[model samples]
Target chain A: MKRLIFCLAVLVLALAARPAPLFAQAGGPLRLEITEGVIEPMPIAVAPFLSGTANAGELAARISAVVVADLAGSGLFRAIPAEAQIAQVTSFDAPVRFADWKAINAQALVTGTVERTGADRVAVSFRLFDVFAGAPLGDGMRFEASEASWRRLAHKVADTVYQRLTGEPGYFDSRIAFVSETGPKNARRKRLALMDQDGANLRYLTGDMSIVLAPRFSPDGRQILYTSYESGLPRAYLLDLETLGQRPIDNQAGVATFAPRFSPDGLQVVYSLERGGNTDIHITSLVTGQTQRLTETPAIETAPDFSPDGRQIVFESDRSGTQQIYVMPAAGGPAQRISAGQGRYGTPVWSPRGDRIAFTKQQAGRFHIGVMRTDGTGERLLTASFLDEGPSWAPNGRLLIFTRVSQGEAGAPSLYTVDVTGRNLRAIATPDFASDPTWSPLLP
Target chain B: MPIRRSILTVAMLGLLAACGQNAPYGNTPPPGFGGGVPTDAVDVSVFGAGVTDTVLFPVDTWELTDAATATLTAQAAWFTRNPQATAVIEGHADERGTREYNIGLSARRANSVVEFLVLNGVAPSRLTTIPYGKDRPLEICSDEACYARNRRAVTVVAGSVDLGS
Candidate 1:
């Protein structure tokens, strides 16, 4: 009996001496899947970066604030206010007090260190931790860039942290192209404006010499396709971002073309062309300067958008006596009407994931932003307003940015964003009235 | 309501002028004469002389109405009178549809006017169509009357107008 007991004890000790199974440890990494969609933002705490250099303290605070703002603005992560922090982090290398964070209901924590490397260069290093799991989510990453690019560095940090937590890529580093409006409603001066996703770095791509509308970015973010009324006729123009050079899109002498979007491959553009009292969808190859009619109907057909695979096209048409969504072959074929709702539907944009389509719906004298499945089922209205139109999806297909026009003479159009789940509706800050926002793909 | 309001204003002004000229004092309008003003009291000159500059259309349609055809016929005659001038037909839509789709609809509406003018013996070269969609509106109000005023095609006679703004 004694010998058997001794053997059993030795076996137990041997098993205990070995490391716990990969996921059987007291605290292992936690993976959060945003598949079903998260309505409540996970509470996160961002500790001020540790810095010991000339003006490093101020810069560090600013960097951390930006990081917090980026994550909070996403609607997937909520930053716990500094007053809610239970413990302060003074050293980047210090072990995280998971217990303290857990007490404040912080599901995630971020700690970082910032240092001045050169006269005008700084380095930011950060690590994200899952408080409940008591383990670092991903390896720490350090980004070095000029001081002038501090905001971008901050966005990069937030993006990395977001990707680690959400299991999806981040769009914090992306840009938006929109129409900036000023003056009164009757004589509004609208200019094409470009800015960061967070509304930073406001730049006007066109002066107020003429009205511009519907600015769309190429997949590579190197060019923009927009409609200009410079010639007193709405025509699409392709503007190269690098040179600010633009040329008129190819069209027949009497045909007016507008509502342009780049194909997934960025080698072609799909737009609407109006000729002889009839409007239809057309696809134009950017390389060969060739154009093909995609839709040929007496009813108005416009707002053509290509599927991510560039195999199909979805657009808005009024063939049935009311506006509705339609899908057709990319090369042109008989279109299948998708939207079956009572009211008018338009601005059908295929989601990046290709599983859903977002659109602007006008029903019973109310405007709404809604989404539906590819085959037109599972319709969901995400927002309602006096005037809400022009939905542009984030690259991840998780969020949408659109325009909302207020009511009355003081009513002006502005940009607003909402998650695909129809939560976190917030107005995007702009210098003035902004509309027709389109999101660029993730930065290279 | 907006159309009625404009007509009433014009009628009231006409009544005041008649009183000033004949009675030289405030006087009640004669029973039949007060409401005798024609429903079409809206003077064609309000839309610009010789050219009925504005032709309205029904919602989400580019089909020419009988009234619209009448207006376009008058416009064609005006273009015939003014040979040196070129006509730019500006098509507009009410702010009830999507911007891009409205652009398409406006184009169709403008083209309809162009076709009607051509049918009426107006040279195609003398008329060019421009689809402003809902970007420019004759009325910015959201009511039905305002929307009706907005869904229109206006023919502007430009005498060497520089359209390249």
Candidate 2:
């Protein structure tokens, strides 16, 4: 992973310097309560950012477009089209025409400007305004970075705006590591690929020499753990994104290993290892390279995920004669079954917030992507299709991405995201057939 | 390539058996009968064509069926006539299950075949197992007909075998 480490020095300007009582107000700061019921998306206007320098015009427009797309893509906010705007932001420090925005039913507004600061560096600033309150929601801030990394600056601005309104961290700045597939279903060619959350900056991490499945990002977003058939058998390998170097997690030959995940602390990895005919979950210490068997069972046990706090682990197993979700101590112990539904369950992933577990369920010949409380209560299915599996949580735990394969001979797998409330279902655009999407933590 | 070689070998074996005993070497060759030919560097096709190389399994099952056992019995007899042969058993599954779980399931199926072969007089050291799960399907359709064929274990000849008496 080429770290896009931008020098985003926060240059707080004197404008909007007053710490307005946004959150301390009687009605609370502008918040979008994401519930299970239907929600009318909050209408907001993102004015085209003004260009401080002649060379910054195009970059300013591109940056503001990303901000608008990010906000609208969440399905919680609706971007008021630029054609409907009655007032324009002519300068960086221009006053907002609150009456004009209110007439367009724009409850919130965002205005920003971009300027060239150096030969290769640019500065971007933005302010979020509460159109209804006739005040700026928070202090206006500016970010400076290399001109090549303007997209990250735009995402950062979107993140700030999202945080101020929804009271949750933004996921737009994250990357996804997934298995990109092509060819036919019988002889599919799969390679590891990476991209921005919105499908920008697409790049392949590995060639199609061998089949790779389920690329998982490390907690720090610097490395990945995935299963590959490069050794002519399924085995887990740790890949350093920066160096593009990789090594098998276990050197023992003849045993198959797959379905790997990183511990929340990034010090260990839990994966499935098959010896002879039985499969069991095992944890390996990254620092010591020592492996310990976590689940000693003749039954199939795989797809292990660590809770955010690293105190517990959620996985799927067939010990009950049918696949179901289970929870056990992170150090290994007898697991308690958590699924009691009428279908088979597998690929259980713990939410980033540590409150729920997302999984894939098969019932009545239909597959569903679902979530439940950590203890297996409050079960809710988020998606249904011919085949839905491999649910990965966003960094904020507000959404999930999974693979959905259509039925039949020509069935192809694609990536889809849905809110935890079972709303905002949308497809992620990839260059080719894709699956096994794992979201990275917010970029540094 | 192996299939073509096996067909030629069978044809030559039939000619030799007919020349010697006035009978053709049938699909199930008699145990310990090498047909009076040097067995050095015998191709894997003989085992595949004459004794069968693959066995089908029920959905989500590793236990061998009665038909699978009969096939393995013939397989063991063929191995007895060729002691130097080593085999790799590939276990597979249908596309109805998750990827990782199917891997484990297919491993069990492959191990089941290996254990049966060992129990029926084949040397345990002569066998290795790999579980492909749903990754390698023989059929692409989603119906039961295709799935039944996909759920199988194949005993592929891996190393050189000396069939010479």
Best by DockQ: 2
lDDT of each: 0.82, 0.85
Candidate 2, residues B37-154, lDDT tens digits: the string is 4332233355645656788999889899999999899888888877766777888898898888899999999999999999989988999877777877777888999999889888
True contacts kept of each: 0.56, 0.61
lDDT of 1 by residue, A128-181 (tens): 888888888889999999999888889899989888876788888889999999
- lDDT string for model 1 (B11-104, tens) is 6456545433221100122222345543233224433455466789998888899999888887777666555446667788988878988888
Superposed by TM-score, candidate 2 places the C-alpha of residue B93 at a distance from the truth, in angstroms, of 1.5
Clashes of each: 0, 4
Error of 2 at A421 (Å): 0.7
RMSD to the native, candidate 1? 13.1
lDDT of 2 by residue, A1-444 (tens): 233333222223332343332322457667665555436688889999999877899999999999999999998889999999998878768788899998998888999999999999999999999888888999999999998888999999999998888888999999999999988777777899999999999999998767689999999999999998777678899999999999999888889999989999999999999988999999999899999999988899999999999989899999999999999999999899999889999999998888899999999999999999988889999899888888999999999999988878988889999999898999999999998999999999
Candidate 2 local Cα displacement, residue A50, angstroms: 1.3
Question: What's the lDDT of the predicted structure labeled candidate 2?
Answer: 0.85
